[model samples]
Target: MPLPTDTYRALTQSVSAELASLRASTPDVMKAFGDLGRAAMADGALDKKTKELIALALGVAAHCDPCIAFHTQALAKLGATRQEIDETLGVTVYMGGGPSAMYAASAIKAFDEAAGATRG
Candidate 1:
């Protein structure tokens, strides 16, 4: 099933609030992240697919459920296959050991749901 609009909205708002708070408390960190993001975007060596995969890996490493879900959808929209997504999550499992397994599963489900919408 598609995630409810309210759920999506709340997730977006919460993430925004958290990011805003982080920016306020650690402006340098936010600036650094922004710079790194820009640099990554500028690097033509990594295609959009590879970049989303990298983002997925980071989301898994950070244990951010919302980020995982969001990036999963983004990757799916970019035409990443289910197998590719699973493989990416497997990498996360290898890096994060055990606790990340569940998060990866959840992310996969989120990706599937998002993909379903686009297919239909």
Candidate 2:
């Protein structure tokens, strides 16, 4: 729920480890992933709102709970409303089916708790 700074750092470190492993095994693949990440961040056709929505959907599709939670928090910091988050998850459900629905709900709960902590 309430994600502490340690938890966030740990999650990011774990993801970094995974990426490092992938880079060791397939440098080209890792390069592509880096390229894509850079491209996503670059100002282009998709604005911040669209990019965050896409990130949320991808996080759901990948079933990465940490990613989902993190992005939801990020979106909220960017002033995304509860309704928007709910609708994004709904779209995730449409794309990823039932399992994604469950994960999305969990992600939402985690995000809500984390956001509440910041508010207090």
Candidate 3:
């Protein structure tokens, strides 16, 4: 099932604040992390959209709720379709097993809710 829209919205807001605090409190570390993330997601052998999907799958495998929400929102903004997400979830489930399957569902729910929030 998809996450409640309000919950997804709250998670996004909370994460933004947390990330901001991390940047303020640990500028050096956060800058390094941010630079690596930017480089990793930049176009090359794998495009930005594909990297986002991979990140989403990893988030599911790791059972990180905030990561899931953040990546899902990024994927949506990058024009990822439902079909692509479904296929990515299939691979994530296969590689990560039963627990990942459950988290994949949660990721999808969060994505749907986030997408709605964006539209509104």
Candidate 4:
């Protein structure tokens, strides 16, 4: 279920409209959440870019597709390179992520099964 990067643009736009409606329905909660986002993202010890990178890593690790789309879209707007994205995902995997689980499975299978025979 790989999505094209451009799909993120559409996803962000669609989610923005839904968020507006959500705010209308849950004004207090939405306002609080928005406030939290703004406060957290404001630059202090870390810049916004770093925060977004962290978010991207967390999103990938958590398997949150929408989070990935939103963060990648943000990173793109912030001038993130392919290297940055790749490194971020690399860190995410290093930190024990869904990607790590996938690779770990393959590693175990490879270890258990040689070219043609199974091992103990």
- Measured by lDDT, the strongest candidate is 3
Better-scoring candidate (TM-score), 3 or 4: 3
**lDDT for model 4:** 0.63
RMSD of each: 4.2, 4.3, 2.6, 12.4
Task: Return the top candidate by TM-score.
Answer: 3
List model 4 lDDT by residue over 1-120, tens digit each.
454334555555677877898899999999999899999988999998889878877776776656766676666666666666667667778897667555333322222222122112
Measured against the true structure, the TM-scores of the candidates, in listed sequence, are 0.70, 0.67, 0.88, 0.73
Best of the two (3, 4) by lDDT: 3
TM-score of candidate 4 on Cα atoms, chains taken together: 0.73
Overall lDDT per candidate, in order of appearance: 0.76, 0.74, 0.87, 0.63
Candidate 1 accuracy as TM-score: 0.70
Ranking of models by lDDT: 3, 1, 2, 4
lDDT of 1 at 24: 95
> How well does model 1 score by local distance difference test?
0.76
**Runs of candidate 3 exceeding 4 Å displacement:** 1-6
In model 3, the worst 10-residue window by lDDT is 1-10
The per-residue C-alpha lDDT of model 3 at residue 92 equals 97
Give the Å shift of residue 52 in candidate 4.
Answer: 0.4
Q: Write down the lDDT that model 3 would get.
A: 0.87
Tens-digit lDDT string for candidate 2 (1-120): 344435543564577677787799999988998899878856588778678878888987898767876677677676777788889889889989998988787767756765665566
